[model samples]
Target: MYRGRRRVSPAVALLLASLGVLSGCTNAPPPPVVESTSSTPTSEPPTEPPKPKVVVAGIDELRGGFNPHVLADQSPVTDALSEIMLPSVFVPGEDGERVLNSTLMESAEVLEDTDEFTVRYRIRTGASWSDGPPIAAEDFVYLWEQLRRQPGVINPVGYRLISDVESRQGGKTVRVTFEKPYPGWKSLFDHLLPAHLLKDAPGGWSDTLDYGYPASGGPFAIRAFDLDRGEVVLMRNERYWGPPAESDRIVLRAADRSENLNALRSGNVQLGMFTADASTMEALRGLGEDIQLTTMPRPVTSTLLLRPNSPQLSDVRVRRAVLAALDRQALVEAGTGGGPAANLPAHAQVLAPSQPGYVPTEPSGEFADGPDPERVARLLTEAGYEHSGGKWIRDGAPLNLVIAAQFRETSYEAVANSVADQLNAQDISTTVVTPKGDELYRTMLATDPGVQDPPRSAGIDLAVAARPVSADSAATMAAQWGCPAVDPDTGRTSEFNMAGFCDQLLQPTIEAAVTGEVPFRRASERVEPTLWSGAVALPLYQEAQVLAVSREVSGVRDGAGFAGPFSSVGEWVGAPGESYDW
Candidate 1:
């Protein structure tokens, strides 16, 4: 089992107290209040309440604006921003469970025993947007039409199944009829935009709101956005129907990895998130006990994806030999700094170990603990390869393979170097390539265009990348490894299926899992074995999201998955008597 949070050493705590950073030490009692010296009955003017302290948070760049309907802006930063400024019918809990947001919705249920599947939702009486427009059924209808028409947008799979939406009781009640049964209907309307704002935009609904959001319906509203300065300021929504936010304002700013660490050391930022490697955690420990670290398993897993079209990996034996030559445990330890509490070896591609529905596939005898040179040589020989002059040669040609990873992922680059060294020691010739920016994505989605006499290889035999899984295990699995989503008109493929993995034999099982025809565990069990046997991708380990906070901050909670660290920001409170100039 994975631990949610790890405690620091006792020596670090002592250092924090000595530096006057830890505020939890013992304190003396306060003095009693004394009576006023003067007996005059003169009245004094009332004093205004002190302003709430601003909490500065560091995050990556906010790409694609705040509107998630636009495919480009649907990033982790957008997810965090939406949690603070949008109204949702269902909210995700810290334990990977969904709960109703009573502030926006009163009740949601499915009509029983009907030929047509329909869901009814009742909006809260006082729910209104920041600009004084009521949150009505018309907003949902508009959202459905936009998403239904734009199939290639961010998440249109579920909306495409809905046939119609009807509003009753003057926009208070909504009825949604689906073309088929969808057990995961609660995940549909997590964020809804105000219909009145975008209904009259010029070009199209998908591309109209690409720059910034105009209004908010949640606890916080956008005060200012300066793209050139890379800063966004949010203040409490005075028109909110629920209780006021605990903190008056939040400031999100873009910063590099080094800048984020420096800000935490100087008390400029109260909280930040990063991919915690061992070195980063050690550096934080040196900064004293004032800095606190908490970790939770992320929904992403690192894998080495193989191109089936490549001649070197087209043979199943050659793929098996490649797996047997590398030590997955060492790679995982090096990538995560040997912190068992922070990371775990990945056993399945469809679901993370901490997720709800995960089944461990039986290990193949090869590559379980460490490298097996004997197994590698045996497999290579069976595939008509022989060792010669420290390299495997077949048909008088050297069996050289190229491995590549993105330059931005430093940890992954280190792991790729280590893999190359290990494979070379076992008489396999492997070269490592590091591509930056657009070149990296192009390499991952490489395919033959059939323009030449002989089709060339995808230019990479194996690529190192991370696959992000969702709480809905079935849908995520289908999207990652099932049939490719090809455009009917352009003959272009969806970006989701970049690996180009298409197995018709498993299509029915994937459909059953996606449509909720079978239990999650049963579907997972039936699919994981086939995925493992094919060896198209090899998962190395699971990554954990690391959050650093100051000792003065409280009410910081881990999200259900990768929703964001600020899911519970409304309840956050700073230390008493602390002064923040913002």
Candidate 2:
């Protein structure tokens, strides 16, 4: 007879199994039956919920100060965070072209295009920050007001031209009027910050984003930043209006090349972007097809700044002597660390190698492979310096200049050391100093104080630093060489200008270029020669970076020129993740 037997429920079966009642064969299981002891019902065993799916990306640097507009804070981590956390009006499309971010903005147009230009931006309806406030004109006004007058901003020229930022239509529509025609107006107002929270924050503009964002407008929100642990986690923003992030969490793990490779091997990290060197590239190539490598060129050009603010280097002839004493080819070879930048030796002072209309502006007086001994000696003599005991002496004091580079920045430190070595070999007294990057840029480079209320010393005589060149060429030129004005309130000079020194003769030309009254090419042509002859700085190479993606991670690929792999982080999928390692 074909008789069917009743089946026990899952919970009962689990309880029975725990009571030694489960049997493989149905016929055999009829031998014994388990009974409950009390009125309580049996329940299934507890199982853990699925772990949060996470994708960790390995990067080289992860210092805070993520305000995208700040110069000292412009790093790989900043760019990655801003692309995913902050909303932008225009972003790089699939083909690297400027495309309007339809998610945040409805439309942007040139309303008035006469001598005084005006741009109108309409924020999308219902587009609000992670907080309750709407993304509107106040954000634009905040960025402009800060960048235009901030001491250590990235590029303020475009923002400085703006005469006013007018809020219309209940603060949704923003009308920005430029004092002069700004052709690169589209580049302004990127990564709009939460003005309402940060405007009167205790830390002010410099410390607006030091810890984490107050509100998120993009797909992810900052969960935590544990600097000591070198890990920053971003979780999917519950209040995000756009499509949900593919991964539940994304982690930015700051590590070295070996540490990154180890994480990839352990399936801990799926993507890595590091400062490429010969050793790292060799090992990465040995991995065969396990990882994909892409070379990226950054916007900054690595240069050796001979700061004229230093009394020792104030004389142009001495500065020229220092430049002519080094073998720049050797500097490039050592500084590039046999990376992609070794081939792309920069020749322009104002424009980056990737920028449009960039031309090699290497001066006619450039140093050769081996420095010209005669030129070095003559320049030093002309600067009232005499070589005594194999060291240059001026006015009974040895001309000992200190060259500083940021500590932990391998490439820049290499360049500074190499420069010092070359100078020592050429009988030029030089000392090398490596300070923390924040101190080097914010405290050392930004200040050139005189004897006053808070007396300060000229910290670094010269610096091996990267000068960021943006879409606005005029702004770049002015930032490097423009004359800083005197501040009446502080009774001190403006620290906005890099080099802590500027040429009055080229100031008018820089201003004209910033205002768009003169063409970029013409202004740069006039300003570049003075910079080179004056020995203000010597451009070595552009910042070349690399991106590596593990095949284990899906949707990990290159973005475009100057676009990092994190641009599409919302779509990445990874393997099952374990609990947070902390």
Candidate 3:
């Protein structure tokens, strides 16, 4: 994600003020300073109070107690907060390169052995949690144990490969040994919980840590979390080893896109991050000089995931025909408000266009940017499908497919509608189903056990979803396509495979990538063709990450993917000449 600032037009500034503007002055000029005549002829002018703590909106909800390890509660907001309040040994830079965060770790190195790989991290001196517990190797061990034992933790695939962890140097050094060479080892340990807090819980860490974590080690700590009001307040961590946070308090309020926009226009929030559709950007520009827009290439790809084993989609020809029937460019244009530079049509599913080692692959056949009716008809016919009365038929039944997507994200809903419309127009009977809350989770992972059965049985054939690829493309690709891991004790399969897709042909490439046996570019190139051949996921486009900040809010940095905007919160400064009291 690139970080560049663009100023709003003067006309837009006037419009924003008329809509609902926050006053330029936050503290009413401090009553003109009162001259201080009674203070025995004060020798020096009073120091200006700090500006009001910056308020930011656009957080969807405070879930999983702001813990990254908690799978169910992980959201954009929580991910952002985790980066601010947890220990991150390495952080992804604006260009998707890894940068060391020296406040958390003094140094990190990878040592290769004959049979295993060893990664060591040395804790920074005087690194302690807000509650007085010094950060130690035990925290890393606790994190690994919790993630290994609990399958519900998100992104546990890499941690599962770690055979053991050893602590040395008076508990200041942590050594992680992997069974084999893991290329993505640098991407781990971004969020580490304090082991002392939950080490003695009777229940598993996942169940016992549902509530929000109250202590923190990073630049900020949680001060209050009012779930009823959907608001969270974070104060600067006094014990932080690095430079203190710029703002005295950072307030995050849960609001929808529309609410967040209104909050921005009204000055209730100083910074807001959302999808900068053309209209939204235009609106912000029209609101005038108060707003500043920053644009970055989103690391997420909007995708249409097809069920692997569904009888209807089992045929490669049918899948290819379905892909050929939709116009990907049109879908992207509509989703990004016709801003060509804002989004790009995605051809590869494993790595986004902006990521390193990404090579663009062309779509198979003549389906590149098309609603190719002739090609669709020809493929369908070759696959034993017949068109009668403007509806496709196969095996004496109408060719009906259900498209599933979550209703919570507006972009997915729009993409799903567009895809469904395109298919329906091409003689395919299509139904768009949007589920929310528990139903939405079940719909997304329906193929997994206890998720209301496979959605294919419910006539759902396609799903519009968004998948985030990490800077370490190897680990991400492996997690998505590698064989599922089965627990020896429980005889249950891990839920890491969302599409229930397993191809022996692709597994070797994935394995090579995961184990650093092959170069990332070579492995990615090798796997891309096979993924396209299977037609498991049709990538629509790479969404752009957009954030609107007030003119007074400076030092805001853009983060990679779901890391959000708080990666450099220590440098964030509010309005000038005002001191923040609360």
Candidate 4:
């Protein structure tokens, strides 16, 4: 239901143009050959040759430095290794709707006679690690144990859905069982690591400019890495178990947006990721036959997080007043969408309609117009606050609030400013604080009640964050709202409920969604209303993973329509120029 914004990374453009070098975007005709004349004969026997496959170039800061244990800052690096190293049970389509198959275990049904919540799995019998070791139950058990120990490993996105992961191995069979029914069980398909290789490896795994991430389980492996030069190369695995991957090798290079655009135009690379300004998108659009450009949606949302713990924002009235004043639709229109931009407004709860537990709520009428300073003044007065001249007095104190967001993203900063202006009209002072990434995260981590060792307050009032939803389920929606999750800071049961907000009324519905014996779909229908009424997480547009491919390449399709362009890589192939299959 939510039409997402197009993602166009610079690297995607370069790759599309590179295909022109291999073969024209339009099919190329056979080359004319000079025949040998009066050649003394001889053909003893004829030998058949192998087919030429399409070679693509991907962009990752470090082709090999991706780690499953650490918070991944490198999407490109993860995308490159996803096919080989990452593991998930199901993958989302380009549209951020539906699911796709990966290394599927034969059966995933819960066992009826089992002592606990166990599900039987018949892992693809022949599945093997990149090092030729067979993929078995032990690997899963080991990985889960390792993950539990390193709880700080970010991207716990969908991983927290499970209560436990137990495995049984005998001969070539492997069974994975869960402690509870994780509604979005299909999300675990993106990446799986090799337990044997990392079992004894110190510090789990890491990436550096000089070293690669780890051995892969996908079609390619890191053949070369150079951090100083900011580039890496991938070669096809000759002993791949499944149908040999279409491409034997893919070369990836790192470059800035400008450099990536230049590469696409000159045909130096065959594929690139593109995300730039409107002018940049327009420029690439005019390139025509030289390179092919297509837009895909990425499952990402941009938000303006409000941190309430700061001295200036201790009052609940200030926070509510801020939300009441700003124009959310205007912000969505100004910042998102393609060209003029088509951003999915976060008027309702965070999850898209396509996602489970999604209930559409009216945006225009839900809250009042543009921070009505007069209205805010009334609310403050009701809360025992008085506006004396220009300053607000709450118990003889000034009414002020501090908002935080990273300085890099101008859009969020603009949102902060707009909110500030509206709140200011009511005589409530607002300060917008912009910090760098590490500084901001550390500040928030220490102050946020959810992630801190000992939460300073009821969690930062608000913090803007983004995560890819790997599955469509009610649990996913709840996680985004920060509900029912264990609060690391307080050692209390809390969801990412950063607002330190909860509704006892909604708990039963949420519990039903989580522990219901009925199907996940049924549970979702039953739970959506509770979230809608509570105003959980505010929704935002779903951004796309911008991917550019050369016309010479064929059979490329994304599972979630055009959003996740890499969802369908199994059928991709090289163009049949002379003798190669296109």
TM-score of each: 0.74, 0.85, 0.80, 0.73
lDDT of 4 by residue, 1-582 (tens): 123445678899899779766776457676799787976765434445554454455452443335534433334455545644444545555555545444545555556797666555567766666668776666666655544333224434345444455555552454555556655555443466666767676755432311654566556666766777776666666645666677655556787766776777666666776553476667666557756665554444555544333344445555555566566665554455243234344444445433445455544455654445565666567667776878878777786666655555455565556656656766667667765544444344333344534444223444444434435445544444433455333566532333334455655555556545455555555455544434433444544345667676666664453224444454566543223121
C-alpha positional error of residue 174 in candidate 3 after TM-score superposition, expressed in Å? 2.1
lDDT of 1 by residue, 1-582 (tens): 123335778999889777664443558555699888898865544555565667788875654445665433444566678788878888776565877788899999999977888999999878988989889898899888776544324345566568888999989899999887877778778688878888987744655555556778887887877777777888788889887788877888778767888988887888876666677667766778887777766556777877565668878788888888888877786677665323567778677777765656746573557899899999999999989898899999988888877665666787788888888889889989887523444334434333222233346777776666655667667766766544433566544343556678887887677678986678777777777777778887777756778876777776665556676787777543333344
- Badly placed stretches (over 4 Å) of model 2 are 1-51, 94-97, 113-116, 447-456, 485-493, 579-582
All candidates in order of TM-score, best leading: 2, 3, 1, 4
The true-structure Cα RMSD of candidate 1 reads: 14.0
Number of the top-ranking candidate, with lDDT as the measure: 2
lDDT of 2 at 574: 70
Q: What is model 3's C-alpha RMSD?
A: 13.3
Misplaced by over 4 Å in model 3 are 1-75, 93-96, 112-115, 145-155, 167-171, 194-213, 227-230, 254-268, 339-342, 364-368, 388-390, 436-460, 488-493, 559-564, 576-582
TM-score: model 4 vs. ground truth: 0.73
Q: Write the per-residue lDDT of candidate 3 for residues 1-582, one digit (tens) a residue.
A: 123445689999899987544555465553464455564653444554445565465554554445566433444666667778888788876665787777788999986553568998899879999998889998898988876556434556678788889999978999899887787888888688888877886654644545566578888887877777777777779998888887777777877667888878887788876666677667767768788777656546777887675668878888888988998777777567765334566768787776666667754463555788888999899999889999889879988877877656667788888989999989898888886523443335435533534554344578776666766778878766766765534777655365557877778877887788887788878777778878788877877656778866778877664456787777887653333243
Residue 424 of model 4: what lDDT?
71
Rank ordering of all candidates by lDDT, starting from the highest: 2, 3, 1, 4
Candidate 3 global TM-score: 0.80
For every model shown, the clashing-pair count is: 1, 0, 13, 64
User: What root-mean-square deviation over C-alphas does model 4 reach?
Assistant: 13.4
For residue 467, model 2's alpha carbon misses the true position, in angstroms, by 0.5
